[model samples]
Target chain A: MIKIEHLSYHYSNGEQGINDISIEINSSTSLAIIGPNGSGKSTFIKCLMGILKPQRGSIILNNQNINKLSITQRSQHIGFVFQDPKEQLFKSTIEQEIRFALRKRKDQKDIESQVETILECCSLTSHRSKHPYDVSITQQKFILIGCALGMNQDIIIMDEPTSGMDYKGIKQLAKIVEFLKKEKKTIIMVSHDLDFISEHFENVMIINHHQCIYQGTFKDACRDETVLSQGEYKLPDIARLSLMAKHQLCTTHQEWIELWKKR
Target chain B: MAQLELSNFSFRYQGSQDYVLKDINLTLKSGQFTLINGLDGAGKTTLGYALKGIIPHVFEGTLLGEQRLNHKVFQEYTHQELTKIIGYCFQNPWTQLSMIKSTLEEELSFSCENVGYALEETRFRVKAIVRLLDLSHLIHKNPIHLSLGQLQTIALGTILVLDPDVLILDEPTSQLDPLTRRRLFNHLSDLKKQGKTIILIEHNIDDFLELVDHLVLLEKGSILDQGSVIDVYTRSLSIGRDIQYPSLTALLSTITSLDKPILNDNDALTILKGVKSHD
Candidate 1:
C-alpha cells in the first residue's frame, strides 16, 4: 500500500507545482492519473518517482518512508517510463538499454534470458541491435517499456506511453499491461489517452491546477461533469457512446453492447 | 489555387537498395483536406518529405519520378518560395522550435523572420496566428519553461504564421488534451474554409474524421488504400489494417451493424435509433 499526505512542491522560481494533496493507493489496484497538460500531473509524478523532492509531504510505501530511501532502494520498488521516451532512452543499442537496467539485479543467472523475454514481449527482437535513435519513435517508446520491465520493480509507472504510437503499438502496450497485472505489479499511468485508460484501468486520479481534485473509480469520474471540466478531459469514447443511449457508464465496447442489449 | 501532383514517384535513400516510396501516383488538389495514417515506419514521414520538396532537396537518394506544383517541378521553385507555399510541421515539436527565442511570441515570429519577412509583417502574422490558435494564455511565457503540450501549440503556431498554402502536420494532437484539440480542430476547419490545402498525418483519427476530405493509408512504402474517407475507412476496417479506427465507429460496428460510417457520436445515435425504428 502507498499512502501520500499533505504533498506540496514549489519550483525554484517560487511557482507552485502542486499544492497540499493526499491520497492512498492500495497495491491491488492499478491507477491512471488523468489531467490536462501542465496541470501538475508531471509534478505529481516526479515527486512520486523521487526525481523532484516534495517541499512538504509524506509518501509511505508498504510501511517504508520513501523519502528516506536511497535511489537504488527506491529502484527496487518503482520503475518509471518517462512521458518522452527520449529522456529515458540513452544507450547505443536497444538491447544494451534493457541490459543496462538489469545491471543491478542480484540474480546474475537469468539476465540474458530476461533480456530475451523483454525483447520478445516488446516486439523489439528484430530491432535489438539497432541504435535506439535509428528506430522509429514508436519503437523507442517500446524500448523504454522494455527497460522498465527489465527493472522488474514492484511498481511500474508509465507516462503518456500511447503518445505518438500507432494503433498496433497501443494494442501491444495493452497486452503488456495485462501481463504486468497478472504478475501482481502495481501500475501507474499518467496520460491524456483517456480511451486507453478507460479500457485498462478501473481507478483514476484527477489533478488540476496543481491540486488533487478527485480520486476514485473511472465510472464516478465520468459521471461528474465538474470533474471532467476541471481536468479538461472528454468522456472516453466508449462511455460517451454508451451514455448517448443510457445513463450508465460503460468501460468497454463489449460491456456497452451488453448493457444496450439488456436495456 | 495550387494543385500538387506526384506522378510515378519513387525514392530510395542513399546507400539503400530499396525504395522507401514506390511509384506513388497521387494528386492533392487545392483546398482538399487529406488525412493519412499507417503503422510505425510506414513511410508516412518519408511521404511527407516527398510532398514538401524535402526529398529531392535535403535527402540524398535515387528518384525516378516527378513532383510538381502548378505545373512546375519542385526543383524549379526557390527554397524561399517552397517555404512560403508548403509549411511542414515535424513529428517532434522540440526540433521545430528555434531555441534561440525566449518566449512563445518570439518563437512564432522566428518562422516569418527565417522566411525573410520584414519586422512589421512578421509581427502582424504572429499576432494573427496567436489569435487564430488561441495562444493568448502562453504568448509571453518562456518557451523553454513550457510543457510538451504548450510547446506543441507554439511549434504549430510558428508554422501557421507563415500562412503556407499547404499545411502538413505530423500528429499535432499527440500531446494535446480535448479542449486544445477542439480549438485546433475549429481553427483547421476555418483554415479549410479559407481554401488552404491541409494534409494531416495522424495516429488518432477520432477528432478529425469530420474534417477529412480524402483518406490514404500507407504501409511499407506503398499506398495500400486511398479514397473517400468512408470508403477507405470501411475497407481498412474489413481488412483489419493497422490504421487507427475511430473508437465509436469500432464499437458500433462490433455491436450494431450500421451500413454508413459512424463518423461521430451523433452519427451513431441517429443511425442506431433510425435502424431500431425501422425494425
Candidate 2:
C-alpha cells in the first residue's frame, strides 16, 4: 500500500507542482490519474518515485517513508515508465533494455529467463535483438514497460503509455494492463486516453490547478460532470454515449452492447 | 490543381530488405484535409516524410516513384525550396523544437530565419503565427519550461510561421489533453479554411472526422482503403480491424442494425432521438 499526506512540491521558480495532496492507494489495485496539461499528475508520480522531494508532508510506501530510501532502494519498490520513451530507453537492443534493471539486483537469479519471459509478455520476443529505436514509438513504450516489469517492483507508474499508439497497439497495452492486474500488481497510470482508462482502471484521481479535485470509481467520476469539466477531462466516447442514452455509463462498446440488449 | 501528388511511390530505408511504403498513390487538392489512418508500422510516418520531401532528401533510401508539387516533379525542388511549400510536424514534438532558441518566440521564428526571411518579415510572421495559435501568453516562456501540449502548439507554430502551402502533421495531438486537442484541431480547421492543404496522420479519428475531406487506410505498407470519411470508416469496420470510431457510430451499430456512419455528435444525437421516438 502507498499513502501520501499533505504532499506539496513547489518548483524552483515558485510554481506549485502539487498542493497539499493526500491519497492512499491499496495494494494490487489499478488507479488512473486524469487531468489537463500542467496539472500535478506527473509531479505526484515523481514524488511517489522519490525523484522529487516534496517540500511538505510525507509519502509512505509499505510503511517506510520513500524519501528516506536511496534512489536504488526506492526503485526496487517502485518502477516508473516515463511519458516519453526516449527519456527512458538507452540500451542498444530491446533484450538489453529489459535486462538493464535486473542486472542491478544481486538476488536476481536466472536473469536471462526473466528477460525472456518479460519479452514474451510484452510480445516483443521477435524484436529482442533489434535496436530500441528501430521499432516504432509504441513498441518503445512497451519495451520501457517490459523493463519496469522486469524489476519486479511492487508498484508500477506509467505516464501516458498509450499516447502514440495505434488501435492495435492500444489493445495490446490494454491486455498487458489486464494481465498485470490479474497478477495482483499495483498499477498507477497518468493518461489523457480516457477510453483506455475507462475500460481498465477501476478507480480514478482527478487533478486540476495542482490539487486533487476528485477521487472515486469510474462510474462516479462520469456522473460528476462539474468535477470532470473542472479537471478538463472529457468522458470516453462510449461513456458519453451511455450518459446521453440515459443508461449507466460504460467505457467500452461491449458494455454498451450488453446494456442495450438488456434495455 | 492538386497541391501535392504521389504516384507509384515506394521506398525502402538503407539496409532494410522490405519496402517501408509500397505502391502508394495519393493526391491532395488545395485546401483539402486528408487523414492517413493505419496500424503501427503501417508506414504512416514514412508516408508523411515522403510527402514533405524528406524520404529522398534527408534519409538515405531507395525511392521508386514520383512525387509532384504544383504540377512539378518533387525531386526537382531543393530542400530549402520544399521547406517553403511544405511544413512537416514530427510525431515527437520535442524532436521538432529548436533547442538553440531559449524562448518560444525565438523558436517560432527559427524556421523563417533558416528559410532566409528578412528580420522584419520574420518578426511579422512570428507575431501572426503566435496570435493564430493563441500562443501570445507563452511567447516569452522558455520552450523547455512549457507543458507537452504547449510545446506541441509551439512546434506547430514554428512550422506555420513559414506559411507553407501544405502541412503534414504526424500525430500532433497524441500528447495533448482533450481540451487542448480540440483547440488544436480548431486551429487546424481555421488553417484548412485559409486554403492550406493538410495531410494528418492521426489515430484520434472522432476529433477530426467532420473536418476530414478524404480518409486513407493503410495496412502493412499498402493502401487498404481510401475514400470519403464514411466510406473508409465503414470499410475499416467491415474488415474487423480495430479502428477508432465516433462513439455514436459504435452505439448505433450496437443498438440498431444500422451501419450508417455518424461523423459528429449532433448527427448522432439527432439519429438517437429519432430512434428513441420511434421506440
- Per-model TM against the reference: 0.95, 0.93
CAPRI grade of model 1: medium
Count of residue pairs whose backbone atoms collide, per candidate: 0, 0
Writing each residue's lDDT as its tens digit, candidate 2 over B56-159 gives 99998789989899889987899998988899999887889978988888887888899999999999999998887777877887887666766877888889
* Cα lDDT listed for each candidate: 0.86, 0.85
Chain A only: list TM-scores of all candidates.
0.94, 0.93
Q: What lDDT is obtained when candidate 1 is compared to the true structure?
A: 0.86
Poorest stretch of ten by lDDT in candidate 2 chain B? B270-279
| Candidate 1, superposed: residue stretches over 4 Å from native | A68-70, A106-109, A260-263, B237-242, B257-259, B270-279
Instruction: Looking at model 1 chain A, report the run of 10 residues with the lowest lDDT sum.
Output: A254-263
lDDT by residue (B80-158, candidate 1, tens digit) is: 7887899999888888898887888888888988989999999899889888877888888788666788788888888
